[model samples]
Target: MDPPSSSSSERWLWWMDDEKKHSIADTIDIEKSEDGEKIDARKERIRDCMTVLGGFLSIMATGGAINSVGLLQTHWENNQLREYSPQTVGWIAGTNIFLSLFVPVLAGPVFDRYGHIWILAVGSGLFVVGLFIISFFDNHSAAPVTLGMMISSWGVLCGTGYGLIQTAVPGVICRRFDRRRGLANGFSSLGNSVGGVLWPMLLRVALERLGWSWSMRAIDGLALVMLAIGNGLMWGSGVPAVGIAARPEPESSDNEKNKEEQEEEGREPSLTWGQCIRDGARCFRKGDFVWMTASLAIFQFVVMGVAGTLPSWGQQQGFEDASLFFYVVAVVNAGAAAGRVVVGSISDSLGRFNSVIIVQTMVVIVGFGIWHNVGTNERLLYVFAALWGFSNGAILGLWSPLVGECVHTPAPDHIHAIIESLRLLTELVCGVSRLCDVENFGRYLSAASSVVSIAGLLCVPSSAQILGTLGPDIHVIFFGTLLILSLMFMVMARVTFTGYSFKIWRVV
Candidate 1:
């Protein structure tokens, strides 16, 4: 013990000498220090911020486009790729989801240990390469041979660069917010709806103005711009050494005033994998998963189905883009982007679970009937777009937070992964359903919309359509019914939470 003390003293004495010398090699803040604390200067790389923001935007793009190709599935079947089946074309979009979700498990850890600059860089490269691949591959060979649905579009090139952004986004958000986590989350998620609205219009324009090859090339170019911006922004946001934060960085601080307040936030030290698993298991055993997963699953069903059908819905409603299929998708996405924030804020105040019920019910009642039926009128379609944008937007924000309610595990990773996988499938199904209905010329949609509205009312936690008839004046009535039902369920949940935080059903 005496000998060890002598050695420890020598190490401290050496550190003190280094500090006195102001040696750059030994100095923590020799380059630039955040909040005036000693820090490894290299930790504050500008590219890291851009990587974080880009990561968020990347996922937003994936979510928007995941089910989007279905909007084109019918078009593909009828026109340039008439020989292709709907399911085959649908697979391209499906593949996007599959790779986007399942393949990126390691990304979070990678970003945590290393920084997101290279990840985002690779993402940018993939986006460009994927787009270019689709362009040349779609054009070069003849219909059956070059156009073989199995070979080209679905080929490995498609999902590669297309979704690198998604893999990066959440990790960035996680790093940025710990206290007002929900607020940061709300804004970050908005990117999806924004991308949803904007991309469709972009695609619509290129489809008509540029035709197939150049149109896709144009999109690739646009993606390049987005990527460049992400790179620039992320690069500007400096990276800090892991586990070294007494105060926020001035350049890229979370912008919080009270250090104590920041400490109180959700960004607390995350539990170890073993500990997380233990908590997650207990929560699942309690049955929180059923409610949370059901809610998210159903929410996706409505949103994805709508996304898939939006362009065709517009087409059936007699608002065909003619040459701007992608453009129309952009319009729908734009509305969604605008309205989703509305949904998020409102849901936060009204109750996350309740707000979803209210929003989806309205979509079903008015959207399918008044909007879908009247969407045939140009002015009416404008109204419909506004209505759809507002409601669907709410769903994105409301669902994820509820996962804690559903999955009580110490670690949410398992639940999040399973939900992501299941939700992807449901979205695919919803997309396919919407496309099939759209091809049937909008009649089927009108009927389904009414039924789905009622479905939202009954589902409170998931997707279960109780009504058989496509009821009349349903929108106005459902508005009342939705309010009543939402309040009722909130009361029920509140009572349960108050009683025991629903711990009884916590495990399953």
Candidate 2:
């Protein structure tokens, strides 16, 4: 007899194996029909492009604004909230940073189930409205901007909106692309960097020429346009038909159908609220997950801590030209944008966990070697900003993708909950829809965010208080120690992930 075709041979093997049953149908590779495969490949590429483009635009508006908090801190202190102490004024920016990360805790699970449309809509609306409200008050007006107004409009509203948009962008990207996930996230994140560069320049010019009212309104208008177009493109971006992508879907025999029916009958009808909490808690049982969360939380603290107080530290360093501070913010973000793309691409090849170890080491070296010594040298300050931004960009770009990687391998569980719940919580540390499915990336991401966002909330004000009480030199050491702490946690996470293997070349 002639040898069977490759597809037929695979099917024969699958049929012969009784232990290899799956509830979901697999993605069929119609290799016998070349035309069908070509069409599917073409369609998949097109969809991926649309999603990336949409993510770029949305993240530009959200991430760009969030990254610009350092600039805002300097502006408010000099113009509107000048009378307030730096530590007090830092609260406004701190609250904004806090909400931007924290609100995602709620938005993540919602995005996993319902898709990105409604959440993005709500996020876009809140974002624009916050800026619009802020436009009405400035120093020259009868009703000047107050700390309360800034906190409510800028901090709470804009931050919450950004949290949703930020979550949705990475969540969809992770779902669509697995192997090239780091590249996709890095490229789309360029929007934030671009926004970071552009927003500072735009605000500086607008503030000088048009005053605060018009400047806020201008950003509000631009954000609305960018977000609207982005929302349209991301309409179809959500959980796809998840299964074994290489396996062909075969016609079910009578016996196979009966077996599936019996399996379905044995599953629970529904998962209760208590079960959901229990499953979420189980995710923390993994040492790798816990270490990763600790590292990210410290990362958040370092980022917000620096952004909140960097401008004030510059002023203290005796920089006479205030405009230079704005330029520094722009340049830092420019370096960050470059870093996200470069290091992000590198992570794809170098392994995400390995890249983390490398970048964090660079951060610690720069933090002590350069940043600690740059006193009055403007050139050194600029160099530090560029180098720090580049290294820090990797942290932001790789974080969600790292979570995606960690959540891919779920531990065995014997829970009797609904099939949906089990799929969503296979590892029970970070929620995965199935053992390795991308459907519930949001839940995994949210679980990680919840653990880290508190750092964002407290770090800014705390940093300012430290700067006030001790001085620039002491503050630098404080933040540097935090970086070391973060690096230690990342190392521990890598060790746990690798099962303490001595082979360093292994791709995590």
Candidate 3:
């Protein structure tokens, strides 16, 4: 039952050492777990569930609410602030998005070292402060006001509050469930979907009915409600019970053998400012990391491209209501929520890497292209948004689980942190700046998005079969047999290629 201390490289120390397993399970005190010492689990599932609910709310409150900017650019342009360069205004969001990713690794580790109570409280304050800044700040300042405000709400405050909760909630529920990890994660991821559904509509109504400031403050109110509930969840039920805290037995001696290799590598560095730069460089170097990040980044780029320009694209093609934008965001978020649960559950049965490759391929073809084309047809436009929404929603949730698969047999902590870190780096980028006027720029944006996403998809893990090299035929064949193969890997991580032996790739 003892884990091999010989290998402790990938964050799953439990798999490597007997004592480390205690930290993940019930033996440690939630309070004591923060101080480089093991403690105990509270054994409270109901409260843990509440913590997850709170997390869902917080993510929903913040996740898609601010993404409304692509839609908001028009208003900003029409306002006196029309002088604000697209890049300059983008810094507001870009900063928010970037920091929201980066600051969290440090915070997540700290939450591991400390606890969620203070982190949540502080993060909630930042969220409120951010909301106030957005609601009240006039962009008349000589400096970029939107940029400044986003950093406050989006970067520092949301990063801190949400970061704390994001780390804490799963830690809590994970302690509570063995049979339901996917369901737990899925349930928690839904908050954003719920918010995605509500926020845009609220933004529209409030802008016309309550005005920008009030509408934003109204968002603040909603945040407060979510946080209050989150507080209850963290405070009451975030730890595991005693008996369940025991170290889990390995599935086989092979797990121990894997642990032996890991113990030699040690833990991930507490990434300093320099580590961030290196991560970008390293992301390029590691084949798996490079391909994975590109795949995910292209997904986001497409998302931004679609989000920013889709309405215009729809308008251009003569399906003119701006209403579809919000609906798309909502549907995408909802689908993402569903994707996380379903896909995650599949990962349990299938391999994580396989499920993602399969799902992402479908996402590109069906969710983005086919669905998009159909949307252009008189009736399918709205349906297209709904379809895209479902697929996109799953993409974000896929990160953590995919990370779990990619770096299997590691200490869960380290694996989780790395996954989160890469996400942060991507969010931090300045991105290619937009030049033409907003509307025209949108068309260029979506086209560029499509192109990039297609390029990203070029390296689908097993494309050598048909194209002989990573190329267009591979891209064209996206929704076909490869998808089934990818899905097959989920259930049966084995290659079915004829004449080719299974030794090479059946288990990846």
Runs in model 2 deviating more than 4 A are: 1-48, 140-145, 172-183, 236-276, 408-443, 501-507
Tens digit of lDDT per residue, candidate 1, span 1-508?
Answer: 2222333224444445544534543354433445344344344433443444554565554455553554554455456565654334444444444444333433443454455667667866765676676666444236666455433443344454444565455545556556655655556666776666666666665676777778777877776777677666655554443422323333434545444454564233333546533432333222223233334434444454444334543444355556544544565667676666676656555655556556666766655466536634665656666676666665555545444332222332233465556544754664311112112211222222222333322221121111112222342243335434443443343323322233332321
lDDT, candidates in the order shown:
0.48, 0.77, 0.50
* Full candidate order by lDDT, most accurate first: 2, 3, 1
Model 1 scores a TM of: 0.60
lDDT of 2 by residue, 10-64 (tens): 4444444334322111223344467787898898888888889999999898788
lDDT of 1: 0.48
**Candidate 2 at 43: error in angstroms?**
8.1
Model 3's alpha-carbon lDDT is 0.50
Stretches of candidate 1 exceeding 4 Å from the true structure: 1-71, 104-106, 109-115, 139-164, 177-185, 240-284, 313-328, 405-508
Say which prediction, candidate 1 or candidate 2, comes out ahead on lDDT: 2
Greater-TM-score candidate between 1 and 3: 3
Clashes of each: 57, 3, 34
In candidate 2, what residue range of length 10 has the lowest lDDT sum?
20-29
